[model samples]
Target: MFTLTTLVLGLLTATGISSAQSGADGTGGIMAGLITPHAYVQKRVSSYDRTGANADAIHIAAGATATILDESGPGIITHIWFTIASPEDLHLKKLVLRMYWDDESSPSVEAPIGDFFGLGLGQYFLYESAPLSVAPDKALNAFFQMPFRKKARITVTNQGQEDVDSFYYNIDYRAYSQPLPSDTLYFHAEYRQATPAKGWTTDWKSNGDPLVNDKKNLNGDGNYVWMEATGRGHFVGVTMSVLQNQDGWWGEGDDMFFVDGEKTPSINGTGTEDYFLGAWDFGSHPFSYASFGAPVKGEELAGSRSSVYRFHLDSPIPFTRSFKATIEHGHANARSDNMFSVAYWYQTEPHAAFPPLPSVEERIPRIYPVGGPGNAGKNP
Candidate 1:
């Protein structure tokens, strides 16, 4: 037992703590990359001018694909940054980001450029988190390390009608001389949306009748699924966009996670806002944290939209056989609202194919009342 414990401790010291310290982040303190030198070459692929001239940003024409990177790698993609200037607010949703690992025909990471940067509604806002962030001037940044043993291909598709006049980007990676670990997994980000989620058919707002609309949810049936995955891996986190079609707070929902095909969810949360690490309807304030944040807080009223995200960098939910993650539309599933999300995780190969991406017109963030257009434009 003593020998086993010593060996395990040594392994953890070299792999867990030391590995992070010696990553692309080349600075900090005693934990520095230079301390334990390894055979890895840091490289960058960007929209830098090929000539010594000044054409910095690439102009991706409408309905065209831009291959930002196609490289052979026993390497890890360390960082990614992008910024854009366009007239369409929906361009964020229309422009797609796709990345395939080990030369896979299909992309392991497929999502809207904005959603991948933690801006769910296809809108830009300055916010910061551990893994993703958006700085001033709509500069987006992502720090998810994606490892590939063979080859990696990354592309951005302009599905919009108008050209992306200026699309600036930079991708940094580290080429490793040694092979990746046996447990190293592929990074995947799949986008899902219920442009308008189904909820109670009628508006139950009677003056005298008090309806709590509360019920217990077991078995995880009919829940708004974020993503369901098979094999062994860990859940990183998700970015969510919520658009309110009714007049009032639209966040009474709870989060549920089913691990390994279990009938009951081993993990559950109190409410939507609570699961995002905020309370009292997020207090209608923008806040950023290392783990979770609500960078864009819309007014708690009809026609409002909010973007929120949570990253599980420190505490990743592990699953051995399978995992299914879902969240309620509202308390007891009682709200009809627009919802868009992207769930990020790292897992073994043969990932479940993602649901079809909705058409660009469907993703434009529309707000329509559940009951009808009788009381449209009016909050209450």
Candidate 2:
């Protein structure tokens, strides 16, 4: 069976009546004919031989930025691969990714490079999911399909204190001869973080029953919002990292999704682990699935950290007017952990404005122990 993402993309890209809607009225696919054979074009944007030598990679000075890929479209970014030689984890959080679609001055996508590629906590571990993966020795891969009608620009900004002396990447995209359909959606990824999440300190466990003393939050007010936007699109899911602040499970919080500006969420999950498609505190095992996985499920302890992701490839949450995707910091919004997340979605161009990227000081993935004070979460 085709995943909903596959089905939607296939239907969206169909060449006429073949479920690939290549042009106007679906008749264009047939009229274009199979004899001429549609042409496919490809290009790679990489750190390669910039100075007439075989040496690749770029040395991005601290606080400087590089335009890695800039192309006129009627094209789709098919695959992206990246790896940094630096050993520090902070670089992952410091190096940001930004993409502009079809002449939009502001970015439609903005996030930390690592977080955007699934290492949300600024650390890398070998893991895989349908849309993203990590290989041995810190290789990062992303398979999100990004379609553009007029133009696409991708850049990497290094906000770190140390210069990135070695940065390698390959961005692969395919160019199309015809214009993309009007309904085709643009890709988006946004990042958010709240170290030592401002949660209740009273340890109000709900005993796993949502109805137990849970009457206060009808609007998901205190939930850790992964992404919120006003637009027409579908929620692709998120990359999440939870640095435990208490000695108990950090996933008792629920996943709540409010669509179309509803006061109450229409899609509510059972628990944080449930939203990530895990059970029993993720079994303390690193695992991957077709649509979801906890690639980095650290030890179940205070200060322990884990990275998890869920891709709604099967059924992306569709929203016509707006979307607010959030999850609790702890059961009943009671534990103050370090929460970092990147939300992925697809919508038409001119997307809702994104909040400013958090400062490097704020983006650092530090661990905060329960009841600790003053940036306990800022250091591991």
Candidate 3:
């Protein structure tokens, strides 16, 4: 069950094809040739007025769910755009996004709308990436290609107590006359959070002190997980938001990937910033790029929020059996900080059931009285 991402990556590895030349095959970028006719019919499901009026937005009452799209397919979703207006705070986290493929009873994708769009801390900030983006003035967009054979359904549930004043969207897709390739994999995104990651011990002088750095974490024990999946597919990327509960740097931890149930991580990185394609604590300023970035840089102090993202578009990590992506909170998992993240990938159907989403009160970011400069050795 190779995902389309894996197929492309395999081709690249086998043929010695450069990433920039990927579009030379007439399937990729602007070089894909808009002048050339396409095989599928372009379609869109949007929040538009049925009677052709100007009021194109819809209001979703509290605890209500809005089915944004339901269509029979041999179709592939290409793009999604949304702009929301709500009075409630943290509306992004309160709105849950779910999508199903091929009439599956379980959702293939489940996450907070904000996290899915790379706004993991329930706050809006402009950033762009190959698959997801948050544009000026609170516009969220996604360009992930999601293919389905029999059906595709997308919905948003309002889990808050206040109604969403205005919800607008445009979902662009391609309706194919023939069936999709059998090897095409479905898209998925799952959210996970640790309001405050528990550390082994708070008895430390500083981040680099021997008390904190001497411990070993060769197996990623007690690491905060980005995602875990039991399937055959490839991992695409992750967006993570961190709320500092301590007074030092929160990214001394390394990233480890245990693929196919290996006793130890087969793929490991030097540090969190290194895995995110940054060095020296992301320097003094924030930066954003097409594939990897830290858009919201936070101070090295308590009660600060930072969001970072990285997409393995050029090289999606493939797995045959299982994949568990995790990262330490600090060196050897010794930092107590709040973390929220969403992992994206393409996989075969019947994915492992996701863990239950945290309660609304738990999802909101806040300073937990934990191991830190202000509340050292205090319980959360």
Q: TM-score of each candidate?
A: 0.89, 0.85, 0.93
TM-score, structure 2 vs. true: 0.85
Q: Candidate 2's residue-wise lDDT over 1-380, tens digit each?
A: 42323333553332222212213344343344444434447777888887899779888888898998889978888789998976455798889999999889989889988889878777778886657888888899887778888888999898887888799999998787777666888889998888877665533443443543464655677889898888799888899988876556778788999999889888887888899999988884688875688878877567688888988865778899998999987766766788888999988666888888889888887665446332233333
Q: With candidate 2 superimposed using the best TM-score fit, by how many Å does residue 62's alpha carbon deviate from the native?
A: 1.1
Residues forming the 10-long window of minimal summed lDDT in candidate 3 = 11-20
Stretches > 4 Å off in candidate 1 = 1-34, 206-212, 372-380
lDDT of 2: 0.77
Q: Give the TM-score of candidate 3.
A: 0.93
Residues 180-211 of candidate 1 have per-residue lDDT tens digits of: 77677788898888867876534554211134
Clash totals for all candidate models: 0, 5, 0
Error of 1 at 314 (Å): 2.1
Clashing pairs in 2: 13-20, 14-20, 14-21, 14-22, 15-20
Report the Cα lDDT for residue 235, model 1. 88
Candidate 3 global lDDT = 0.85
lDDT score at residue 175, model 1, on the 0-100 scale: 82
Worst 10 residues of 2 by lDDT: 14-23
lDDT, residue 122, model 3? 91
Best candidate (score: TM-score): 3
